[model samples]
Target: MEGILNAVVLFSNFVLIPGMAYGSQLALGALGVTLIYSILRFANFAHGDLMAFGTMFVILITWWLQSIGVGIDPLPTALLALPFGMAAAIAISLLSDRFVYRFYRRNKSPAVIFVIVSIGVMFLMNGLVRVIIGPNDQEFGDGARFLIKVREFKEATGLNEGLALKLSQGLTIAVTFVVVIALFWFLQKSRTGKAMRAYSDNEDLALLSGVNPDKVVIVAWVIAGSLATIAGTLYGLDKSFKPFTYFQLLLPIFAAAIVGGIGHPVGAVVGGYVVAFSEVTVTYAYKKFLIYLVPESWEPESLVQLLSTEYKFAVSFVILVVVLLVRPTGIFKGKVL
Candidate 1:
């Protein structure tokens, strides 16, 4: 029984908790991508860099707040600075829509054109973020680091293995739940939400039924901007923030969005967990846990990891390719590519 408990603890520590937190972040990012695709009819390749831009704002504001000696005890000061980050992200999104995307949209340009434009936007945003924040890792999380420390858990349980829960992990899960609920509620019950859905379902019919196209577009960008900011900030808190890391993050984010069915919000959320768990489970070294469970005589010589940590991101790409090949519509019956 002690061995079993140890195995469970080990698995939970290395796989379950990390996956959940990472999943929550991916869900938020995927939701943003899905929303823009559904409403605007284009894949915004710039979305990842946009997240970095928003997170940069949060990091800056967090620094300013800390310098002024203002902080939330037990929680990271980044939480307090999130709103400012969202505001800046929203402003940039709106400006991009107005100055760059608006012309092509008005001209009824093909979706491919919009995609190419978004790639250009992605490069610009990536460069802008590098200029503002530099190309290095930034640590903005300051306060209570863990909700439950490993030593405390081991002492409390008198167990051979311990479970550690970080404050950032708890925050990520809680904030994601609240944000997702609010988003679904807004989509289901709010007037603008209905209008947006109507527009998504059929733009000509919605326009004929008195739905304002411009308003729907603006609302989509606003929601996407907010999601991007929250997801990026939460991830930076959980890990460390580096501009290039976010750019690399685009692959997983896009994979999550596509895997879940590109235009479906619910699919996006589900997809995030799938991708996160796959990545964690595949890359984790299971040698220690196996030793805890198996007899000493039967213990393996090598670590039982399927892939190295450096290739973790590649897991998402492989899954993406498989999903695209097997079921292009994804798990949710989303729009077929």
Candidate 2:
């Protein structure tokens, strides 16, 4: 009885908490991609790089701030530097929109061509980040490494299960909530946001109705940039910041967006959490937790993880394919067709 109880506790601590935090991060990242796809009318292969660039910006600012002996007291100073990073990302997004995407758009290129252009832009951005940040990992987010210690929780709870949640994870969820609420309010309630939606629904009608298409596109990019920065910084703060890791993250982000239903903001949020949980749960060895749930005679010799650690990405891809097959529209009724 005690052993089974212990396993359950351990699983809750190790699997659920980490998964929730990661899902929040991926959801935020996917939201940015979905927004761009809706407004820009292309699958932005460069988005992953945009996230990388934003994190790189934060890394740079964090280094500068640390050099100046400036740091947040109880929280990571990178959180403080996030606004600047967000602005920088917005600028970059706008510039990319102007220089690369805008030209093709004006040329009346097919979306297939725009998709090709986006891939080129992705490579360019990847190279740019590599050149600037040198294809290296930069650890800049600092302060309050953990909000709770597992050992401490064990002492307090006196249970088999104990959780050690990070402050960055808490901040990521809180910030994501705030950002999501603000974003939805803007899209569902605000004028400019409604205008953008209108433009998305019918570009010609929006133009005829005196809605400035350029303004809407610019606004969408700005929002996308902000989301990219926020997601990147929070993720860096939670784990570590690596420029290349962001590129690698694109697969899961797409999975989340696609699984949650593309172009639906709420879906993006849900999709993020779903992907996060899937990644963690699939990779998490459940032996510790399951030992408590099953009798000794039933206890398997192996760790009960559904997939190996290295197969996390594979798990995400599988879930995405399954979701698409089961419900093409997505969990939140996002547009699949």
Which candidate wins on TM-score? Answer: 1
Over 234-293, each residue of candidate 1 has an lDDT whose tens digit, in order, gives 999999999998888888988998899988899999999999999999999999999899
Estimate every model's Cα lDDT from 0 to 1: 0.94, 0.84
Worst 10 residues of 2 by lDDT: 1-10
Which sections of candidate 2 miss by over 4 Å? 1-5
- To one decimal, what is the Cα RMSD in angstroms of model 1 from the true structure? 0.9
Cα error, residue 287 of model 1, in Å, equals 1.0
Candidate 2 lDDT, 1-337, residue by residue in tens: 6665677667767777777778888988999988987888877878888888888888888889988999986888887788888888999889988998999989999889988898888898888889998887677767777788888988986876777888988888788889888999999999999998888778889999999988999999999999988888888888888878889889999888888888878888898888888788878887767667776788778887788888888988898889889998888877763
| Candidate 2 residue pairs in backbone clash | 3-292, 4-292, 7-289, 9-161, 27-272
Q: How many residue pairs clash in each candidate?
A: 0, 5
Best by lDDT: 1
TM-score of every candidate relative to the true structure? 0.98, 0.95
